[model samples]
Target: MSVRQTRKYTHKFHAPTTLKTDSIFYRIFQSLPSTFFELINQPASLAQAYQFSSVEVKQLAFRIDGVFLPNTSELPIYFAEVQFQPDKKFYSRLFAEIFNYLDKTELINNWGGVVIFPNRSVDTGATERYTELLNSPRVTRIYLDELTAIAASSIGIEAVKLIIEPESTATTKAIEIVNSARQQIIDAAQQREIIQLIETILIYKLPRLSREEMGKMFGLNELKQTRFYQEVFAEGKLEGKLEGKEEGKLETIPQLLALGLSIQQIAQALGLDEQVVRQAAQPKL
Candidate 1:
């Protein structure tokens, strides 16, 4: 008789801290890429000529969080990294990835790097090897905490700052950002996207609170009355109804979930019952 053996295995789920922060930065770049150039003290107009993206170097198994590529050779390409935790080898890894990308692309234009940290304390990366590079003008480092001292009227900057705002004050800052976006952004669609971004940020920041509670905390009912929100939701609802497909409405739940909205909120937004939304949100496996 053959001997039989049994093995037990356990799995642990780890919430990705880097992914959370990176998602916020990616969304910011997607919605308002100019805010990035603004943060680096560069002309915001530069954003107009650049499109932001994330790049991966599969050969070395390296990935860059963000890259702003110029439309032409006239402008330098930008590499952006959001570092919330301390890593002794950050500069080494960053430079390696940057140079690798440059080598792979064979671009002749100059390049710049921007690193964002929550504060100086967390920027404990070893820099002895890259001292000259770090000291050069090609690299820019931003401490989010330092940004609070300057009073900026730009809605984009305000939204960026809200990410590092303390929990006690985050709600207040978010309301201000929403109101500022409403007044500053003339385009209705753009204004709504900004508001949605703000909502997404708060959802990540305050995960303990239910969506209904967040809506109340941020005075979302008042926001719903705004023309931007009304128009966007009305269009979505009309499109779904016209298709006469329940799946059309359900498809939005995943997006809302990705934005940190709870199933209850998704249900309310889609005019569906909680069970239906919950079922749709479940993993197919």
Candidate 2:
């Protein structure tokens, strides 16, 4: 299976800590209803997904991982940031950048903002700073790890991974979730993506499982032909186009990069060799 190219900006934002956050965020966004795009004035399908800005605010230069602008003339723009660590200054920096964007854009309109944290404990900002703002209803903070009421729906399974648990339990649950997802999803493309996601999770949780178990888990042959598998292949085509071989880079490279895939993963996603991806990573000059 080929790993596709993600957005160039994605390369700037990856790390072990962020990978889990990214996976969950991507899945959440993917699973949202079509009306979500309508709410944000975005396209209906997941085709043209995210618009990332390395310099969301000049001088301040915040990298926005995902953004969705309202289609209606009157609605406010939505700014989203994903944080996996516990930083005390999170809100301080967040509001600073937000006001900077508001001032720079001269947006004399209302704005909606969301900050997603892996778990409630990861949020270290002073509640006092956001007390009034939280009361005002324009901002929301979500902690993925704190949600452990009961699994009323399938989405609840993804939510459990955010919890701080023994590696063994997490691995067991992840395996259960993947098995369930594979059996439940009929769409080949979506099913493939789910399996890929499961594999990615297992790579991190490998310490919890025996080497033989891990190998057996990933040894399946059907993984190479799933929709998720093909998408990664498509990413390679994008990398080629971006290199000006056949398709335009603007259309291809940035698209894959935007998906936040790793260079190696992108290479695999596209069915290209690692050397090709490494070469593509270099500047035009």
Candidate 3:
């Protein structure tokens, strides 16, 4: 993936704790930069114009990571900062790093910055020295909790919102998000990434829940692709088992029964009447 160069996705938000919320946001940036652009009130298509990566300011003894560098020099480079905990020096350090990188780098592109906090309250960085920069278009500040007016549409944005969702409703919301991802995203790999990302977020949100329990909440989309499921579905016509004959179909009913499908489900799947499925399900003498 070319980092931030992806499509636009919009959705409303509402929402975690320690266990490194910043890293979760980092994962979001890696997997779905569209959500970041949406958070900044930019078109999701804009992500396609930028590449995201980290920059090392060797002289400064630090690295300025999480940057969105436009493909063309005409567009400004965006510095992204995710702040999960309150830091009094956050803005000072942010500006310092940005200016330092700008000074050393040959790229003369204009620069902007965005600071993302879990909520407004956690954004306690002292802005006195950099008030002008902080208040201008050069910088965009996002409080995830305050995001509103977005359509309930983009699965990408919805996944971002999962970070702050309350523990009580997180699982239910996760399931909904997983289903939406499966339905809306056509690309198989992207769909799996979204599903895994959602599951990762839930694992963080509800740490008490077991992985097995969490796996039950979301079908990973690989089941239907397996040979076992292929035979079980059998085109819902008892396909491939006992081919082209009623006896073959009847014979497979025992296999389906052994596989734990109920009589009605097997009947519906095989296009057989319930009584016939029941008779086939009976122990052979």
Q: Pick the candidate with the highest lDDT.
A: 1
Q: Write the per-residue lDDT of candidate 2 for residues 1-285, one digit (tens) a residue.
A: 001123222211123333455444555455433323433334555324433222354444444445555445366666666676666766776776667667887556577777766667667776677778867668866555544543343533453352333455666766666667667778767666666656555555443444335433432234343334355565566435635642353344334544444566556655566676666666687
What's the TM-score of every candidate structure?
0.69, 0.55, 0.72
Worst window of 10 by summed lDDT in candidate 1: 1-10
What lDDT does the true structure give each of the candidates? 0.72, 0.52, 0.70
Which tens-of-lDDT digit does each residue in 1-285 have in candidate 1?
000113211211112222266667778888898999889887888899998986666665555658898989978999988777777877886787788888877678899999988889878989999999999999999998899675664778888888878778888888888888777878877877887788777766766645445444333334464343454466666445524667777776664565455677667767789999999898888
Candidate 3: where are CA atoms >4 Å away?
Answer: 1-17, 220-285
Better of 1 and 3 by TM-score: 3
Which numbered prediction scores highest in TM-score against the true structure? 3
Clashing pairs in 1: none
Clash totals for all models, in order? 0, 21, 3
